[model samples]
Each structure stands twice: as structure tokens, then as C-alpha cells.
Target: MSEGAKLTVQELDKRFGDGDDAVQALAGTDFSIAENEFVTLVGTSGCGKSTLLSIVAGLEEPTDGSVLVEGHEVEGPGRDRGVVFQAYTLFPWLTARQNVEFALRDEGLTKSDVRQRADQHLRMVGLERFASARPNELSGGMRQRVAIARALSYRPLILLMDEPFGALDALTRQLMQELLTGIWEQHRLTVLFVTHDVEEAIYISDRVLVMTNRPGRIKAEVPVDLSRPRSPEMLSDATFLEPKAQVLEAIREESLEALE
Candidate 1:
């Protein structure tokens, strides 16, 4: 692992079941994300991209090896790491602000302080006006905005996202990507994002790591040299195309192997 990395995965392995029925998800997966960096993981189906993110999030345990954040082993979920998934994961009964406040309940802040912080984060995501709207009353993109707001409300050291915008329509997906990138730029929070969309990965990442066929491990790392504050027009630019091509080729090779 790189010295002083904000997050590190070392020789990580994960398996399910036992004996002949066992399924191995990852093996010798090692990588590290530096402070304030945006790194994304991409791979073929069943390559354990999500599994690796879960382990980093401390939601799942690895069979061997370990995940470390700030040089400490991640034994379980902690407030220092916030997570968001594609499903929105919002409670239908609570208003958007309430959902965000829920994440801060264990922080020992007074109810009023929690409410103030929730509103602040909602405004950051352009959702302050919809603070009273529940999940069922909001659109898909709006619900995702709430999820992002909730995850960041407590100001985690690193954000882990699993295809957070995968469920949205194309236009909405693009908008969310822009919004998320803006947030990352403003906060410079370290992020570990997982996605199957090659363009999305290159567009948002400082570096993209491709995983091989399962039991998955890092096959290649493609650095994104595109200057930031990335814009929609850069999608067609040669710089973006270069890293996109690299990531695609790496994943294509793993995909072909999986089919064989």
C-alpha cells in the first residue's frame, strides 16, 4: 500500500459458501487512494467491484487480507466513511431533511443542531426547498440528491459510492454526475466510486482501476489527465478519449476472459 494513503486495500480476498459450493469473489486485490483523490473501479459483470466497495465500506468482511483507512484496519462501518448506492436507500415515510438528520442522530448533537446541519447539506445539493418532500413524492434524481446529501451531512472522511446514478435516466445521470463532481471539487473529499459505465468513470475520476474476471483483482490503472473542473464538452475531447480507451480495453479483456 502507498504510504499515507487515505484508503488502502491489501491482498484482499473474499469467498462465499464452502468446498465445491464456494464462490470466490476477490483475490489479492490491492490498491490505494490518496487524500482528496477521486478513484473509480470498473470491471466486467461478476468481477466483484461492488463486493470490494462493500468491504471498504465495512458492510462486508473479506475472507483474508484487510481494508485500511487512515492506516487503521476497517473493522466495521463507521461515520468516518459515508456510503451511497444506486437504489436511493431512502425511507419513504420521512421527509428529505429527516432522512439526512437520521444519519447524524448518533453524533450526539442536539436536535436543533442536527436540523441545521441537515438543511445546510440539503442546500448544498440544491434540495433545501424540497426538504419536506418524502422519497415517494420525489423523482428518482431528486431522491438520489437526498441520498448524497444525507451521506455527506456528517462530513465523512471518504465517500464510497456504488453506481449511485446507475438507476437514473441518461439526462439525469449526466446532471447528477455534474452535481457530484461539483460537490467533490468544493469539498475535496476522498471518494471511492464503483461503476460499469466507462465514460462515467473517466469523466469523474482522477484514476480508474479495472478489475479482472473473478476472483477479481486489479488488472490495470488508467490515470485521467484531464484538467478539472471537468465539463460536458470534455467528453468529446481527445484527453478524455485517451483514458476512456485505456479503461475500456482493460475491461474488454476481462470481459472476454469471463465469456471463455
Candidate 2:
């Protein structure tokens, strides 16, 4: 692990079942994300991309090795890391503000403080005016923004996202990409996002880590090297195209292997 790395996964491994029925999801996967760095993981389906993120989030245990955040071993899901799933998992019964406030309730803040922080984060995601809207009332993109705001409400050291915009239409997905990148830049939040979209990975990441199929392990690491706060036009630039091709090629091989 690098010095001062925000999150470190050293010699990580995970396996399920045993004997002939055994399945290995991760094999010695390792990487590190620095403070406030935005890194993404791209791979073919079933490459254990989600499994790795879940381990880091402390949602699941690693069969071996360790995941550390801020130089300490992560024991379980603590307040130090926030997670946003592809599903906009807001409580339908709770309004947007209430959902965000729920995340802050464990912060030991006064009720007023929780409400205040929730509103602040909602504004950060451009949803302050819709604070009262229920999840059903909001669009898919808006609900995802709520999820982001809720994840951020408690000021976690890092954010873990699993294809948060995968469910949106093309135009909505594009808009959310811009919205998420701008918010990440503004907040300087360290992010480890998992996606299958190669262009999306290149557009919003400082580095893109690709994994091997099944028994997943890090296979390729492509640094974006693109300037921060990227725009839609960057998609057409040669700089963007090269790294995108590199990532696509990496996954293409793994995808074929998976098919075989």
C-alpha cells in the first residue's frame, strides 16, 4: 500500500463453498485509492467487481488478506465509508430530506443538526428545492442524487458506488455523469466507483482498474490523466479515446474468456 493511501487492499482473496463446488470470486486483488481521488473499476460481468467493493465497504468478509482505510484495518461497515448502490435505495415512506437525515441520525448530532446537515448535502447535489419529494416522486437521476447526498451526509472519508447511473436512459445517464463529476470535484470526495461502461470510467476517474473474469484479480490499470471536471466534449477527444480503447480491449479479452 502507498503511504497515506485512503484505502488499501493487500493480498485480498475471497472464496465461496468448498471442494468441487468451490467458487473463487476474488484472487489476491490489490490496489489503493488516495485521499479525495476518484478511481473506478471496470470489468466484464461476474469478474467480482461488486464483490471487491462490498469487501471494502465491509458488507462482506474476505476469505484472506485485509482492507484498510486511513491506515487502519476495516472491521465492518463503519461510518468511515459511505456506499451508493445502483438502486436508488431511498425509503419510500421518507421524504428526500428525511432519507438524508436518516444517515446523519447516527452521528450523535442534535435533531436540528441532523436536519441541517441533510439539507446542506441535498443542496450540494442540487436537490435542496425538492427536499420534500418522495423517492417515487423524483426521477431516477434525482433519486440517485438523493442517495449520493445521503451517503455524504455523515461526511464519510470515502464513497463506494456500484453503477449508480446504470438504470437511467442514455440522456439521463449523461446528465448524471456530469452532475456526479461536478459534485465529486466540488466536495473532493474520494470515490471507488464500479461500472461496465468504459467511456464512463474514463470520463470520471483518475484511474481505471480492470479485473480478470471470475476468481477476479486486477489485470489492467489505466490512468485517465485527463484534467478534472471533465465535460461531454471530452468524450470525442483523442486523449479520452485512447484510454477508452485500452480499457475496452482489456475487458473484451476477459469477456471472451468468460464466454469460453
Candidate 3:
């Protein structure tokens, strides 16, 4: 693990099945995210990107190795880490505000405190007006906002997201990306995001980790050198294009090999 890393994965490995029919999904995967740094993982399909994220989220256990947050090994899901998935995992019966409050149920806060925190986070995500709306009543983007607010309600040290905007249309997805970056800027929490969108990874990440196919491992780490307070216009600028091309080339190589 690197010094002062907020989260660290050391020699991680994961496999499923047994004997001759076994399948290996990851091998010797290692990386670290610094405090308040934004890191994204990109890889070809079925390269175990989600698997790695799951391991860090403590939703799934690794076959070997460990994940440490602030030098403490992660044994299972805890309040220290917040998770947002591609699917909006909000409870159907509850309104948006209630959904966020549900995450704080075990936080041992007063009812008024919980309600205030839920409203505050919903406002943070630009959904204060929709607080009373149920999941079925909200748009795809709105639902995701509620999900993000819920994940953030408890103030986790690390935010783990897996393609949280993947279900939206292109326009909605772009808007969601911008929204996420804005929230990240304001909150300044360590973020480990997994996505298949090369441009999205470049636009939002301080460092992008590219992984190999099948039994995945970090194949390359591409650092985004674009100036912060990133604007949409910068996406087409030379500085952004340079790193974008590098990340794309790395993924293309692994993608091509996966099709072999």
C-alpha cells in the first residue's frame, strides 16, 4: 500500500467455480487512491472491473489478498464506505427523502436529525423539490440523484460507484456526469468509479486505471493532466485529447485480445 492512501488493494485475486470448470476473474490486482482524489477504472467487457469494485465495496470477498481503508482492512460493508450502483437501488415503496433517510437508520441519530440530513443531501443533488416523489415517479436521472444522495447521506470516507449513469440516454448520461463531477468537487471525498466510457473516465478522473481482459490486472495507469474546475469545452482541447488517446489505445489493445 502507498503512503497516505485512503484505500488500497494489495495482490487481490478472485475466482469462481471449482476444479476443471473453474473461472478466474482477477489476478494480482493492486492499486491505491489518495485522500480526496478521483480515480476511475476502465477495462474491456468481462475484465472484472465490477468484480474489483465489489471487492473494495465489501459486497464480495476476494479469494486472496485484502482491501484496506486508511490502513484498516475491510472485512465487510460498513458506514466508512458508501456505494452507488448502475441500478438505482432505491426502495420502491419509499419517497426520495425517505429512501435517503433509510441509509441513516442505523446511524443512531434522532428522527429530526435524520430528516434534516436527508433533505440536505437531496438538496445537494438538486432534488430537494422531488424529495416527496417515489422512485416510480422520478425520471432515470432523478432516481440516480436520489441514489447518490442516499449514498452520501452518511458521509462515508470513500464513495464507490459502478457505472451509476449507465442506464440513462446519452444526453442524460452527460448531464449526470457533470452533476457527479460537481458533487465530487464540493464534497472532495475519495472516489473509486468504474465505467466503460473512455471519455467519461478521462473527464472525471485524476487517474484512470486500465485493466486487461478476463483475469484482469492493471495494465496501465493514465493520469489526466487537464486543469481542474474542468469545463465541457476542455473535452475537445489538446490536453484532454492526448490522455484520452492514450487510455483508448490501452483499452483497444485489451479489447482486441478479448475478442481473440
Candidate 4:
């Protein structure tokens, strides 16, 4: 696993089934993410956003094209990448510390080392105090935090997030956004995040890639010219809204075309 890994996707394509039943999920998709860069992909529902993400995670193979992480073509799932989903997949029977520890125990760490690592990440997510609480006892946001801590426990090269905040309420979603950005910066982790909310995409990403409706392809790249250390204040300012409108318009046009 290379630190602050770079990703390259070229002419990516994915198809399912065959003949008349064939469904092309992604077509000629191409993009590059710099090491430590925070990039977000947004599109209409079923536009292959999740499918594309899964390919990058090596959970699925692209029907065409290639994915290279730090110049090496990805073969299959590797320890270099960590994936977090919208649904919190923590174990209800385990305490928060145990949940994170479970992800580390398989990494060859000693029991005491695993405990220390779990402590470190749970503290990073601001849940060290809740270490004894099970997923059943945590709020939706906290559960997601535990999921994040578990994913990072392995210290992977990049974090692949698929709608990780989509399940939270508006207010909690905003808070999680703030927390995630901080964690990303502190860890200096390369992050590829997927989301449907246009505003959220602009607010959190260094660049946003708007995708066309299914058989999805990159439609537009909006560089979020906003300065770093972002805050909710940026949302109401031109720095954020301009790029938000650009990304939103790109998606809107693609979405309309899909319905036609």
C-alpha cells in the first residue's frame, strides 16, 4: 500500500447480462485522482456510481478498461484500499472498541497492539469515550463513525466511500461532513467519495465529477475553487454556490437526457 495513493481509470466500461438483456452500466469512463486528493462522484441514481466505486475497490471487475493505483494495475481486493458504505455494518454484539479491533486483529497485530490501534482510531473519530457501547446503543451518526474507524484501522492507502453520509438526517449529515473532512486531512488519505447531493459534493470535494445517467461517463469536472479549511459559511458564499450550480446543471442535463 502506497501512502497517499494516486488512482488512474482509463476508458472504463462495465456490462451486465447478455444479448438483448445486456445492460451497460458504465461506458468509457476516465479520471485520475491525485494522492491525498478528495474527489467526489455524483450522478442520478443508478448511474453506475456505486458500480464504478466497487470496481475501484476491486470488488468487481470492469468489463473494459483498467484501474491503476499508484501506477500499478489493480488485480483484486488488496489491503491498500478501505471501503465504507452508507449502511453502518458494525457488529451489534461488539462494543465500539471491539468493532474497530475486529478489523485490526486479522492484520497480524498482537492483541494489545490491536487494542491500542482501536483506541487510536476511535479517538480519531471522537468516539473513544463510547468504546464500550455497542452499535445498537450508538446514534446513526456514531455508528457511521464506528464504521469509518474500523475501515481506517488497517491504515489503507485510500478510502472509498459510497454515500457514507446518505443515511443521516440533514443536520447529522452536515456534522459528519465536517468530521470526515477533518479525518481525511489529518490522515492525509486519498479519498474517493460518492454522493447525490450537489451542494454536499461541492462543499466537501477538491473537485467534483458529474456523471451522465446510466452507462455513465464523466460529464463535467468542476474544480471547487474554494479555499481549504472549509466551513458551512462557504455554502452561502459564491465560492461554493458557483461550482455547486455547475455540477448541478451538469447532472440535471444528463438526468433529463436519461428520461427522454
Q: Report clashes for each candidate as comma-separated counts.
A: 0, 0, 0, 0
lDDT of 4 by residue, 5-49 (tens): 499888999999999999999999999999889999999999999
Ranking 1 against 4 by lDDT, winner: 1
> Sorted on lDDT, highest at the top, how do the candidates line up?
1, 3, 2, 4
Taking all chains together, each candidate's TM-score versus the true structure is: 0.98, 0.98, 0.98, 0.96
- lDDT per residue, candidate 2, 1-260, as tens digits? 79989999998999999999999999999899999899999898889999999999999999999999999999899999999999988899999999999888768999988988999999998999999999999999999999999998888999999999999999999999998899988879899999999889999999999999989999999988788769998898888999999999999998888778
- Per-candidate RMSD, Å: 0.8, 1.0, 0.8, 2.1
**Clash list (residue pairs), candidate 2:** none
The C-alpha local distance difference test score for the whole of candidate 3 amounts to: 0.94
lDDT of each: 0.95, 0.93, 0.94, 0.91
- lDDT by residue (141-218, candidate 3, tens digit) is 999999999999999999999999999999999889889999888879799999999999999999999999979999
- lDDT over C-alpha atoms for residue 22 of model 2: 92
Q: Which regions of candidate 2 deviate over 4 angstroms?
A: none
Tens digits of per-residue lDDT for model 1, 188-245 = 9999999999999999999999999999999999999999898999999999999998
